[model samples]
Target: MKTRVRSADFLGVVVKYMVLFIAVFVVLFPLYISAINSLKSNSAINNLSPLQAPSHLDWHNYVTAWVGGDLGSAFFNTFFIIILAVLGNVILGTMVAFALTRFDFALKKYIMGAYLLVIFIPTMTVQVAIFGVIKDLGLFDTRFAMILLYLGTNVVQIYIYMQFIRRIPMSLDESAMLDGASYFRIYRSIIFPLLAPATATVAILQTIAIYNDLYSPYLYMPSSNLGVASTALLRFQGPYSDQWNLIMAASLIIAIPVVVIYLILQRYIFAGIVAGSVRE
Candidate 1:
């Protein structure tokens, strides 16, 4: 009976390892292929196996793609927009979540329900209305249009913040109030500082979202100068479609920033998520 139990435990370990390896491969295989293909010439990519590395590295592909795609400007635009959007999202999201959780107000249930309802609404259904509003506000064909659209607090941010904030003891607020601190002062000094974990999680998520969003930039900001990292690839759509090496090089360049960011903050992400999930 003991031998059988040990065998079962060993089998479970082996199965877990196998699943982990498969998941890693599934995530990394495309990145590996892209890195290799980006170094090869267009003709070489056609002749060589997709898995094969380049015999002679050609650095020119990156240069051409960078300059031709106007990726420098695109990256700058993307970075600027992400900074503003994420900052706005974190501030507004935290404040709303704090208000909803810490204070008792009328229609609170209905407000929370409305936020839940927003998560179910398909973005495509109301895009025409959004477009009209953008044009009427004279924000069309501008980077600010993207920023304005992205600045709104979403339910995910609110939920994450609420989960983290709920765990914070109300005694802190009472203590501050007893010291003659105002509600806003307690929120600013006490609540906001303690929400660092949730804030980090929300910032990372919002940053990736705004970075990868091709549709908003493409639709609202049509001007070449205002192009973002995702839309930078669209320049190769018509005539340069056959240039896979340059395309891959461009893709690799665009992918670097977010990858580095995730690597640095990945610990925070996992911790924040776990912290939010289970009651501690």
Candidate 2:
């Protein structure tokens, strides 16, 4: 009986990890293939053996991709848009979340209900409405337009922050008030620090969203030269359409920021997700 129990446990563990390994391979194999191809010479790209290893690693593909593709300028422009969008989402999202969760205001229930309803509706459904507004505001084709669109689309994220904030004890607020701290002061000095884990989660999520987003840039910013990494990757394919090396190189570069961010915030992100998931 004891031997059978131990065997069952060992088999379960093996099965679990086998499934995990397969899932990881499914997700990462493409990226691994791209990275390997990016380092291969033109002739190696044509050879099936390049899948094993490049005969000689060619680093110049990275430089050529950056310069010839105008990726450097695209990187800077993308950086500016992402920075602005993340800042706006964090600051405004936090404030909105705080108000919705903590403050008691008239029509609060109605507003919250409306927000919840809107969350179910896809933003694409409102693209016509939003595009008109952007055009009327004369922000079409500007970085500000992209930033504003990101802000408007962040309602669900703000609601996530609000849900997490609500789980925090209201007594903390009462105690701060009793100690003579103004609401703003308490938020700045106390509440904000306590919410670091949640903020980190929100920031990481929005960073990935803004960084990886291509459709918004394509729709609003018509200038091919002013493209983000996603749009810029299109340059790798042309009428001929077979420079897999350069395409892979651009993709690897674009993926770097997301991977680095996940590495840095892995713990906080996990903590936030677990806490938020199991909590009321």
Candidate 3:
């Protein structure tokens, strides 16, 4: 019986590993194809199977992508927008979450419910209204407009912060209050520091969101000079639509920053997610 049980356990382990191997291959296969094809010429990519290795590396694709796509300007614009938007979202979202989670104000429940409703409502439904407001405010074709939109759309960030904040004991706030500390002081000194993990989580998530966002930038900031990385990639598409290799190279270049940022902060992201989810 012990022998049979041992064999069964070994079979289960083998099956688990096989499943994981298949899953990893499924996820990584497309990335592998893209990387290899990006290093090939357009002719080579068209003639060869996507799974085939390149005969010789062609670095010109990246050069053309960088110059023709105006990636330097795109990166600068995207970085500026991301930094400001993330900062604004983190600050405003944290403060609002603190209020909703800690304070007892009239209409608090309704306000929370409204936020929940907003999360469910698709942004496309309100795009026309938002575009009209931006035009009226003279923010069309500007980075500041994108920043404002990012901040306003951060309902999920606020909710995440609130979840983590709820896990923190209210005794800290009470003790700080007893020492004559004001609400702002308590938040600044005690609560905000405790929210570091959640803050990192929000920053990383928002960075990826803003970086990969194509439609928003395309719609609001359509000026050729003001294009973000995603929109700038469109430059490779039109006349040279057949240049799949160049397109792939440009996409890889655009993705590098996001990949690096995620790798650097993945630990913090996982920690924050776990910390927010599990209650003591």
TM-score of each model, paired residue for residue: 0.89, 0.88, 0.90
Q: In model 2, where is the ten-residue run with the lowest total lDDT? A: 271-280
lDDT of each: 0.85, 0.78, 0.87
Please write out the lDDT profile of model 1 over residues 102-215, one tens digit for every residue.
988899999988987776785556777889988999999988899888875345788888887899999999988999999999889999999987788888877887888888
Q: Which ten residues in a row have the lowest lDDT in candidate 3?
A: 271-280
Q: Best by lDDT, which number?
A: 3
Q: How many residue pairs clash in all the candidates, one count each?
A: 0, 0, 0
RMSD of 1: 2.7
> How do the residues 68-144 of candidate 2 rate in per-residue lDDT, one tens digit apiece?
67788778878898888887887787777787788899988998888667677877778878888989999998888
Task: Mark the regions of model 3 whose C-alpha exceeds 4 Å error after superposition.
Answer: 46-48, 271-280
Query: What is the alpha-carbon lDDT for the whole of candidate 2?
Result: 0.78
Model 1 lDDT, full chain set: 0.85
On residues 18-87, what C-alpha lDDT tens digit does candidate 3 reach at each position? 9999999998898888889899987899899888989999999999889988899999999999999999
**Evaluated with TM-score, which candidate comes out highest?**
3
Off by over 4 Å in 1: 1-19, 271-280
